[model samples]
Target: MNISAIDLTIFVFYCLLIMFVGLFVSRTKKGTEKDSKDYFLAGRGLAWWAIGASIIASNISAEQFVGMSGSGYAIGLAMATYEWIAALGLIIVAKFFIPIFLEKKIFTMPQFLEERFDKRVKTVMAIFWLAVFIFINLTSILYLGALTIEKIMGFPMIFGIIGLAIFAGIYSIYGGLKAVALTDVIQVIFLVGGGLITTYIALNLLGEGDGAIQGFSNLYTKTQDKFHLILDKSHPGYKDLPGISVIIGGLWVANLYYWGCNQYIIQRALAAKSVEEAQKGMIFAGFIKLFIPLLVVIPGIAAFALEAPLSKSDEAYPWLLSNLLPVGVKGVAFAALTAAIVSSLASMMNSISTIFTLDIYKPYLRKKANETELVRTGRWASFVSLIIAIAIAPLLSGLDQAFQYIQEFTGFISPGALSIFLAGFFYKRATANGALLAAIGSFVFSGLLKYIQPELPWMDRMGIVFIFCCLTIVISALIEKKGVSEKSINITFDLFKTTKSFNIAACIIIIILAAFYTIWW
Candidate 1:
């Protein structure tokens, strides 16, 4: 891969601009200092646009660029169900979930658990989340980002891993969520602009001097087998996608857990200026999610159509960037890839610190710690977590498909966590004991099912495990003989009402998704 001087200059300028914006926005008055609220929640002052941009920036990372592209190459358009279903999930979160979280003033997911259940449940889940974030989420992001650097830049993996950690840490550790969120606005601009450029180039190449539209037409003609939205049982990829289960089954568990309940993703909305702003931000994100597959997935399918000379599926994205793009455009596309990687790393680091400092350290280790002390502890936690992830990241090499690996591993926790939250919100009889049991049972049942039914698809396993978790909560509550716990949240119709504009936007999103599935199916 040959780099032009102009490309290098553009990449360097983009990096410098992001750092400057991050530091500039986070700078406070000369006499005042940042407290826990300012540092962790962006001073509770993020606007709708900032919230929307931050959510997409944080969510679309190396995983989508490198990992999901790999899945697209192997599994084709069926892989896009994750992105399409998530658009609907965001709407559900905005309409039903955000209001309760805002009304409760919830700063972290574990904090919500503490209020709804008990400290014991909160502590257990917080520790579980800490382990998952550091080991699975952070490590995978670092590994995939490093994979991209190694593939595109021809650098060694260790250099890429350490370099990205230092880059994300420079501003994110000191400036906190404020810096991370504000800088993401710029990152999204580069991300979308550069991503579209790469896709356009790939399409034009496929069309052989015809425009992108003709390129897509050629693609459909050549690889129509790769464009199905649903994979039937006979399909080679059915074990991963599992036919219609993608629509009416376990994918819902995955989407709701990731979009509505995950700490890092939901943290953006939680920091909004008001619940209205948060809801609007979520809807904005939903609209953006509608076309994300174009930026990430299509390039891989194009590579597959061209019969790219690749050793493995994960290399499809890097191969496209390296072989397809012209001189100056490569830098912009590279920066877009880097933007996705670093933003996600920064967001994950901030979230790891938030969970550890607030839910774990503040409650048990440092009950008397002041606000400044808590903020200091958070910064240290972020640094330490990054170091741990860097050390463990290289172990993820040789994975056939990194995106599927992440989804399957994270599924271990999503079922129980979603069950607990839904129970707390609607089922008044749910008790703290039941929440704890559901949390523990999620892992136990998933493991047992995997061992007992080794051939079952992971998606169906997740759906089955989710049902077991729901029953675990219910049975535990019935055994206790408590009618309704004192901590149960009182549900009201007013909590979920949406404005006319939001309703219209929601209808539009649903109609568009329906059209896509109908055409693809």
Candidate 2:
């Protein structure tokens, strides 16, 4: 794990470049300052490419590089269902979700709740999101990112955690989403390039230097059990994936919630210059997602094939980097890992500030806060949130599979949140009271199910909870004798339409995914 001088140089240069880009984009002309729109939504100016790159950049992090790789090591390619299914999820979000969001002109997810339901629901969900973002999302990212740094550089975990927090906060806290999104374009380049290099090297080593293709062939031949797309009951990892549930059941709830309803993720699409731009960006992300397993999962399977010595499954990616990469290439791969970590941290921080300032502070604490004051408050919010996450991040050090831990805990909120949103979008009779019940019941139902039926697969439990929440909304509305709330969104077919190119790209993605599952099934 000893770092060579050349690798250290490349990593340093990459950090400086990212910081410079972030700061440059954040710069404002004299007498002109960033308003809430500029700071929170990137001034609603992001083009399709930036939106696409930023979405994936913010999405893939140490969770995938470290945690998901760990899952790959333990469960094999079955771990890829999260990424592959997410491709279809992005398309669904693009077609069904983004249009409503853009049409409503909402800044944060909480604002959408307020417009569709009531302030009570908005406030409750906003607080819930804040807690989850800081405690679960940000903390996990920092912990896993630091874990990678510790494995690759042989540094103490605390040093890696603090260093990552500082690097992310330096530009992101000051610049906001504009800086984060713009700089993410470069981050995506490094992330993809470096990740691919690591995969290529690992595969080459597995193939005994025959090349990546032979490496992949050798990997598949030797590790055939790892290639299954669906895991049955007898498989040790079936509980984690739960065979058919991944395709037809609770995974849909997870994907839709994470991609469509999550503030940090949908914020990129919200910032797009147009709805068309947003949809196109989603389409682009879908294509990129199809290849993510190659970068993240294949390396872990390659590690299994090569017999990487590791204390835990999460060490797979780091083991590859430490053992296989040449000096110059190692620097690039490290930069890639750092890029994934910091970009996601920056995105999460920006979203945290956006939700707190716009949804909480402006509405309640400072009813008449102006643009300058709100922007300043957002910056402060970002700083505080990062500090909190950095402090608690070390607690996650004991997790065996951080990815599954994230999914299980986050599921507590996702079922409720997704139920509320889906009801609000399509069910005219959905009342604020009903939405509120679903919001609260989501956590209660999930917890009860987990406690009472500990053997139930987590995905199946989520599906059951989602159904109960949906029913709660329905029964509450029935009891209230409401037909259609005044706040119900007027649906129009035109809002879901996409460009020819977007449609074609989406079709290509679907075809490719179908071929993959067919071959692997």
Candidate 3:
């Protein structure tokens, strides 16, 4: 697949615009120990619109563009679980977790752990989060985006990668979290708008071959099995991805941990001005989540209808672009893809740098460091992490499943962090020692099962491991009941106050969209 002069020019233009935005933000964006708070957490003062769009941009990456579309090719509509499950999880986070985070004014989730539990819990989480974010999450997105260019446009892998790393690092280094957040908003508009256009074109292509009715029938045939929510042992990996278990036992725990507890992902909400604003942002992201299938998954099915069996595993999305998009629209779509890749790269790089600077550097290196010094340190950290991520990116280029690899490595924290945080907040009797132990136990259990069983239901493996970790913490805390803080018995629930009308309205909208998703066609 040759990248035409026009597509290459368009892609380059988007990258330049991203750099321009980063440079623009760096001069205006504040930074210091006083501003360090702003650099890392967007001054803790983002409006809902910015927060909402940034959430979409930061969250959707080349993984979804390439990996998710690949899943659509294999599993059909079943892959939509990653997007939809988050809807339930975000509401839970918006209602339950955001309040606690904002109420405490926690700089990071690990900070919340230290506040509620102990320093040991915080330190352990920091190490786990940093490792997963750097090696697994950041590396995979960089790899997949680079690989997409390598396969689709005939560029060397290193070119797609260094270009991404240097570009993302430059802005992220200078502009900090505010730059990352604002850039994310712009990226998401490209991501969603470009994705919808692709979806529209692919579906329109279906009408050409067999006409609309026959095309719809062919589309159903390609994806019909994916709609069934039960395990079917007959097909390959069917057992690996049974819809009901995939959603219930599997995705539920994973999404809760991701959307609810992961610091890098949830910091967009943490950056919001008020709890109400944060809730609005998460709910808005939830609404956007519902539309993702229409963009990513539906297009993959449409590809099956028109251009069947896209070769070179990752070619699913690119093949559709070659066949579906018109010339000028291809340029816009390419920009959108660039925007998604760069935005995610910037978000991950920014978060990793934040953790290193605040969690590891300042406390251990120079406790008396001022805001100005910390800001400089963060810049250095971002540069170094980008280098490491760029190096690791090529390694993931040929992986069979990007999302699965990401989830596997990410389990090091999500299950463990969720358990520790829940225990700290709800189970007052939970001991810091027990929480730390739970973190270690959860990682070992999940990792061992995933590696050994390989064939065991991934979700149940994760769910059972999560339960084991929760039980360990709960029982240990109960045994240490004598040490529990009696005054902490109350929720100190000030964090949870939100306009009743907003939540009710959000729920009503969800029901309406969900009904349409189910009943339409």
What are the TM-scores, per candidate, against the unseen true structure? 0.99, 0.99, 0.93
Candidate 3 root-mean-square deviation in Å:
2.6
Error of 3 at 260 (Å): 1.5
**Model 2 residue 349 lDDT score:** 96
Q: How many backbone clashes does candidate 2 have?
A: 0
Q: How would you encode candidate 3's per-residue C-alpha lDDT over 339-428 as one tens digit per residue? A: 888888888877877877888888889899988888888889878877888888888856776766676566556677778777777887
Q: Which residues of candidate 3, in runs, are more than 4 Å off?
A: 29-34, 209-218, 229-235, 307-312, 486-489, 492-495, 512-521
Poorest lDDT segment (10 consecutive residues) of candidate 2: 203-212
- For candidate 1, the clash count comes to 0
Q: Where does candidate 3 have its weakest 10-residue lDDT segment?
A: 26-35
Error of 3 at 224 (Å): 2.2
lDDT by residue for model 1 over 1-521, one digit each (tens)? 45678888888988899888888887989988899999999988999999999999999998999988888899899988999999999999999999999999888999999999999899989988999899999999999999988888888999999999999999999999999999999999889999999999999988888799899999989889989999988888898999899999999999999999999899998899998999999999999999899988888899999899989899999898888888889999999999999999999999999999999999889999999899999999999999999999999997978899899989999999999999999999999999999999999999999999989999999999999999999999889999988988889999899999999999999999999999998
When sorted by lDDT, best at the front, the candidate numbers are 2, 1, 3
| Number of clashes recorded per candidate | 0, 0, 5
Judge candidate 3 against the unseen true structure and give its global Cα lDDT, from 0 to 1: 0.77
- lDDT, each prediction: 0.93, 0.94, 0.77
Off by over 4 Å in 2: none
| lDDT, residue 505, candidate 1 | 97
TM match of model 3 to true structure: 0.93
lDDT of 2 by residue, 232-330 (tens): 999999989999999999999999999999999999999999899999999899989999999888888888888988889999998888988998999
